[model samples]
Target: MTDNSTTTSSVDLNESRAPLLGAVAGLGAVLGVIAVALRFYTRVVIVGKVFHSDYCILAALVSVVAFTICNGIGIGYGFGRHGAAVTPEEITAQLKTTIGVIFFYHLSHLLIKSSILLQYIRICVLPVEKRICYVVLALVIAEGFTWIVVLFLTCIPFSAMWDPGLPGAKCIDNTAGFYACAATIISADVAILVIPPFLLRHSSIPWYQKLLLGMVLALGGAATIASIFRIRVIYMATKGTDPAWDAAPNGLLALIEVDLGLICSCVATLMPLFRRWHPGIWPRRLRHRGGNRLETVSDLNCVCSESKSTASEDRGGKTDVGDAVGSGTKLGPEQ
Candidate 1:
């Protein structure tokens, strides 16, 4: 019986450590890749051109910084820098890093998404429903900010948030802090996905086109899911000996939530540009490459075409029989 108990304890210990290590390593790799991508995008895609007012470059910079800091927190925790043997200062620093990175990363994401959605609206026709949708989107962004405020205030009794060698440090009230965050993120994500379908439903565009738009915009939903997943990891991270294991999954989800949200929001914002491009690529038959030739032969092919009746009616109403007959004869010869 004692042997079984010891084995169970051993298993629990390993389980607790695994997540922290995974989070540390995983976040490091994710941040490194993102940094490289940022460099490439700035160098190759923009080519030193600040010609457009997209502000995408600024968003990219914010994301890079947020992710880098988050990875640092993960690595610190993974290495047991804040373990039981560590000093109060180290524990405090780790918690501060974790909170700072998560907060800034999410805030930057909200700002960028709002900017993108506004840009999207500026180009679109903006019917009454769409305007309402924009208002709702604004509210969602506002709610996220509110949550950030609450999180800060909750931690504001900051000295109480973390302290090594204190037994009651285990009892600090974080329930409100984390739950508020979870609610805000989940609600915003759902709102982003829901608004697209409702706004696009009444558009003059075809149903399939609206569906395509909804699907593209729905990518924000993934970020919401990531937040939920991160919350679970966070619970595991904070409850146990090594919180760093939670950092990898938490950082990964954070990066995903911000990055995917930006991409989805940007795509939605550029919908008008896409709409304009699509019509040029797939114009009506009369507006196709052979459009001029078709018009030229239209009169000659009148019997097989619908323009004949309209043309005859116009000629008859003009009260110029001689010109009408001359034109008709010429049209007949061409046919």
Candidate 2:
């Protein structure tokens, strides 16, 4: 708990926090909105239909709204600022802000991970990969639910979390919770990021389009990197010294990680707009790398999660689908 008596150092910390927290969180929210907007347009307008993954994205977007609102409140309450600057009466308010941030942080990750899982359902084709994906999804759900429960119940009598001296109050070490959640996020993100590259390995699509899909899928890794940084900040925050100051970075990183996850997931589904912008955007030499080549490129709307064919059927149509990949682009595969 922070001392009631404040120091000049506390004021300095408090002054720096507001702008830094707002700027980082605002940037994340903006980037997330832009990416998700593109994804929605790509699905509803360009593809003319939505899939399971789109629904997931929608749900994640709702949580993002909640997360952003909580972020504003938290920062307003001196969340990332020094706790000593908070008056005794304001302590409860600051603590409530912390609760809001934690609650929404968990929700954002849960929804974003679910979105990625649903995206995997639409795009992953192999039986082995499908099995792996299913297991990962189950774990993600379990982990997310666990964290939700843990965060909500972390301090008994709930208010004890903020008012540390409350009688009969007990709180769990938050570092454990942070570690568990970070592990879940990193593993799931890595799996989703690696999946597309693995799926296209033997794809009948030309190497040019194959490379493009690979690049798109790789975008999910940005979230994974953000998660790592969030974990580092979490470790520091859980150290129990000047927590309010520490929490600034912790909360900021959480917002960025979840927002980045949402953004990356949405971007992975925006191939339609990319292909639409340039109908003839295929590269040559890379097209020669894949030994066997197809006459048609699959501008698969499913790349945007807009396909009628199951991922399995597309296995046979790999060549045609690859050819159809762009709105109106065709590159001759080297003979």
Candidate 3:
């Protein structure tokens, strides 16, 4: 017979990743809130107006905050300990929180991608550019809806997801579903990243300004990288028997991916604030009329409108490759 003392000692020695998960989740939440707040200040107070994309991002921030809270709740229920070390009640509680995490995680990504695509539609000048954004936006929405349905229907009677001991409990192949979701999300990320360069190439802005904009837009790549790592962790977790212990890394990565997306999206819109504080940071030629006006990629609608008007006048109502775009208007000047 196994010694009771030895068994108790072994259980006590089991590794727990709760602290690490808690720290990462807490830090990510703090940074995400700050980023979104700054973005709103720049758009509403500094720019004097807000757009649909801004509201979408605000919703995304709410979803991410919810996602973070679910993670925190899970941690309190012994989410980061080995399955064998945790009581069955703790496991049930964590599993219930897992459903919440999945819901908020998907919601966060849907809103974030929608925000980016809406921003693209506002900025793009060409018919083809707007069409592409619409197509991508539709795809994101459809995928999000389909997955949400799958999430709820994965178990014949949803409660079976958390309490597998239910009478005749059943669940779909979770591993397959997760893999498919990850693949589609990563694909959408790559598509979003590619659209900016295409829009910039056709813009009338100077090459230096294009380069500056490219750097800011490239921040989205970091979120894609996080997605990649998160998927790898998911793969490993699927192959492991200790789901609770394995879940720590997967949850940490998921939080990072959503938070990174929020932070990066908000940072792109903060150019006006940056320019107000540091006029000299922009190229000399870009400073219009003694820096009273300055155009930025973030002001997509204004820029595209200005481009169309300039093109009409320059080409005498005729369009050409060289006259496709024109200099855009100032985003806004600091008072």
What's the lDDT for residue 276 in model 3? 65
lDDT of 1 by residue, 1-335 (tens): 01111222333333443345445445544653454344334333433322121455255446645655665564555423324434556656766666676677657656655654543343233366447657866785787577566556554345544543455434335544565667777776676667656544433323454466457556545567777887766554445444543344555666666655554443433322333345442222122244342222223223123345346333332112111111221212122
Best by lDDT: 3
Total clashes for model 1: 4
For residues 1-335, write the lDDT of model 2, one tens digit per residue: 34333354635643547687788778888888888888778777876767776777788888887888888877776676676776666657777777777777777777787777666655555566667768877887887788888877899988887887999999987788778778887887787677666656645545567777677666756778878887766767777466667667777777778788788777666766765676444422122354533322343433323233244244543223422321212122211
Q: What is the lDDT of residue 46 in candidate 2?
A: 78
**Mind sharing the TM-score for model 2?**
0.81
Candidate 2 residue runs with Cα over 4 Å from true position:
1-14, 206-211, 282-286, 289-293, 299-335
User: Per-candidate TM vs. native?
Assistant: 0.59, 0.81, 0.82
Order of candidate numbers by TM-score, starting with the best: 3, 2, 1
Query: Whose TM-score is higher: candidate 1's or candidate 2's?
Result: 2
Residue 158 error, candidate 3, Å: 1.2
Please give, for residues 74-131, the per-residue lDDT of candidate 3 as tens digits. Answer: 9999988877777999999999999999999999999998987887676565777789
Q: Which parts of model 3 have CA positions greater than 4 angstroms off?
A: 1-14, 206-208, 284-335
lDDT of each: 0.47, 0.66, 0.73
Q: What alpha-carbon RMSD in Å does predicted model 2 have with respect to the real structure?
A: 6.3
